[model samples]
Target chain A: MDEPPRSAPMSASVPPGGGPGRIDRRAIVDGFPLFVPAVPFGFVVGVAVVESEMPAVVGWSTSLTIFAGASQLATVTLAGVATLWAVAVAALVVNSRHVMYSAALAPTFRHQPTWFRWVAPFFLIDQVFALVALRPDGSPASFRRYYLTLGVFFYLMWLAAVSLGMVVGPAIPTGWRLDVAPAVMFTGMVVISLTRSPAVVAAVVAAAVAFLAAGLPDRLGILVGAGAGVLAGAVAEARLVNDRAITDEQEFTP
Target chain B: MNMSTAFVLTIVIALGTYLLRAVPALLLADRELPVPVQRALRNVGPAVLAALVVVSVASTADGGIEVEVAEVAALVAAGVVAWWRRNLIWSLLAGMAALWVTLVLV
Candidate 1:
């Protein structure tokens, strides 16, 4: 199958006095909005670590070092079974999306110097990918620079927020209901994902299957739900492609 | 589960999590994916995010599969803000404010 056309122009045509190949400052500015949501959610993850009876250092270090909110939350909240094996399994399940993010953006960076290409994946996150995909103008060179800057900015924000959350976790009242933070973040992601119809069907089916299977032990609902969702989405996407191909062939016939 | 032991476990967890995140990208970076694998990767983001949303909303230990009104309301409010404004800050603020109010009033 052909790749989807690049959503944005590859470059901003330079006017008489404009510099060539400069990164867009507006895209970076646009990314600031993402951090506002991320910080409170980070704080909530901090609260989860404390409430789950894990040490503050685990919460802080995991947030800083691991740097993915969902997996960190799953690790701490499920700390009853929180063996090294379980945590590794949960982290693998949650972050497997990054492989997709990296692959989607790989072609854009195929021509970049090898070092930059290697370093770039370290900063790839959902928010960074969304912003890069939405940028209106950039050459491959400019896009690479823009994406790297955006990634670093968000990465630093994540570190700072997690650090602040760790320090402030004790002071926040116990009954403050920080659990909503994860829900908010997850809802935002879901809403963004729902932009496509196949994704919506996948999400609904996955949630239904997960609810039905919630009786399974050892947090296996997550694994089952995620697996079912991916299976459903892949099937739906394949069907959609096949339908479109048939339509194109019919249109080409005399 | 003592403090020092907890700290050690946390360090282990942190290392485990990082290795999981980093290793796949490292291992798969050089390999060209098959068409089916590429298609599967494309669907992974939405599928994973969707599963996360379900788990987040429905996994409370309330002894039944009841929707937490406050959580659901907060999520809907947040979803609306995100859709309408596409601004993460505004969406979060709206969601948090709704949740806080629901918590207070209910």
Candidate 2:
């Protein structure tokens, strides 16, 4: 099948009622490419989940229940070794970054129908959020179709890839180092997602913070580090905006 | 944990994740957030993903500090491609291809 649409068609064929909403072609096509890296990552998760010795039901269930590669792997891996509380905490901390995405997406979701708002977050993974944030225009209108298309597209791809990986099973050796897929995927996403100077600053700060906080329990370091980076980026962004305002005023002096 | 316990933990974690995502989209819907807040939130994507990238590649399968050289090289390759192409599939394919070459040749 053709990949999900990469961008909203400048002109789409939506019928009736302020544009009759079908699943957005742009979103569907665009969303699937982001799934490329996740295919390997899902395979790795599938293998790891199996190795964790959980029953097949529990193992496969996570792919649907969590719908996130990293956090699902973290939770499954932790289950065998850590206490349930520790596992939950690690998973929660891993998922905490979604809070930032959620807040960032709030403006877009605001205009969406109540039912859409209720269900969309279920698909709010890093890839989807990055795609939304990178839009040049950043308009909230018509986001529902884009968001829904991306979500549905990603959900099916992830589910299929992971389930396939599980059936392929542990025959794939660790020496292959397939575990690196998530980092590779995320690295690509990060590079493409960066647009402004503050974004660059934020990435650097976040990496430094994560490195420093490495020993924190339950993988809480990611949460703390992400927070620090955002705060620093905000400061930088604010300063830049202030400086730009001053320059504009000076240029316009009458 | 047993299957039942593991299942329950997964459910709880799922609930926590859903709420984290839902709360903001629900509460902050239909209004312009403060500019500073919006600015901060905009950068959150880069910050969080960067952090995850580091967290993932910095540790080994056994949780050691030593990361594989091939994996690091592959990740760098992927990042460069992503930046240069600005396309997800191309970068990922480039990364995996680089990884294959590195593992085979290096």
Candidate 3:
């Protein structure tokens, strides 16, 4: 809540199995702000399922099986009107960004145990990635605890939020306008990501492209915007390196 | 949708998503990526988050872009609070507060 726990707590606690490791309290608390957006987003997904006239049990199963909120919304909405393959493709594309998250964390995951590697990817959603991707290097034990704690907490919370939605979604008025909640929460994420110049450039370009390409079908616009932003940020990073080299040259020549 | 159709869709989507997340994570471990690729990957989070924010804010149900002033105000309020306080709770509270106030006033 008050700036992410900057330093990992040094004291290691005994695990239930008698192994010793640090249990990160920050991981538990860090998800508080993220849940703000997740609650409304999950509710909207539940409402979509209800509105589409899908069976309640089937709708709830997607939450358990699919587990990702945005893709769950897409799958639930499309399953009613679109073909099965079409719905599958949409869900795949919508959730494909996790590939990037996986790539970014590969090095960190490399040092982790084989079982951890196999299972940890299940929790690689956007909020989890956003929190862990920027984390300072810490012990593998601590990282595992941090990742799993946050992961499980969010997973349960998501299920609860969606279930609550399924129960009450139909009664909620459309005029309540919970639509903008995710945007507000994501804007907070964007703010946190502005710590670097390349990231700033990337965010600006991605926002512009995504705004313009909002008409693209199957959420391809987000991918396009993300690609363009990454390229722009890479170029910016190269230029920064060049400028720094030039500065060093100038200083040394004097 | 029918129960069978729903189950099939869920299973298909679940497998596809898991592979997308797991394959690269498993295969790319311990591999030293090219410098440029690493640099680009580092920016992926910001790029994706920014894209998500725009799409979520602007995209309508019919896949059209619509900018609501109230929503923009809320985003600005959240961004500012997040920047100033460096805390997510305050930012969320500020943004929600701004949104409700603007919904009434505007």
**Highest DockQ, which number?**
3
TM (chain A) per model: 0.64, 0.81, 0.86
| Native interface contacts kept by each candidate, as a fraction | 0.40, 0.75, 0.79
- Per-residue accuracy of model 1 over A159-254 as CA lDDT, tens digit each: 787677767956777565665665586566667657666677677777777776554544456557767876787677678778776432221111
In candidate 2, what are the lDDT values of residues A17-134, reduced to their tens digit?
A: 3234556767766666777667778887878777885676787888788887767888878787887787878777767888888887786676667777788888898878877766
Please, what are the lDDT tens digits per residue for candidate 2 over residues B23-99? 98888987866767777877888899888777766644444455666887888899899988887777877787788
Model 1 C-alpha lDDT versus the unseen true structure: 0.63
Q: With candidate 3 superimposed using the best TM-score fit, by how many Å does residue B84's alpha carbon deviate from the native? A: 1.2
Candidate DockQ values, in order, are 0.37, 0.59, 0.63
Model 3: reference contacts kept, as a fraction: 0.79
Q: Positional deviation of A137 in candidate 2, in angstroms?
A: 4.6
The alpha-carbon deviation from the true structure for residue A59 of candidate 1, after best TM-score superposition, in angstroms, is 6.2
Note the residue pairs that clash in candidate 2: A3-A29, A4-A28, A4-A29, A4-A30, A5-A26, A5-A28, A5-A29, A5-A30, A6-A30, A15-A20
> Which residue pairs collide, candidate 3?
none
- For model 2 the TM-score comes to 0.84
Interface RMSD list for the candidates: 4.7, 3.2, 3.0
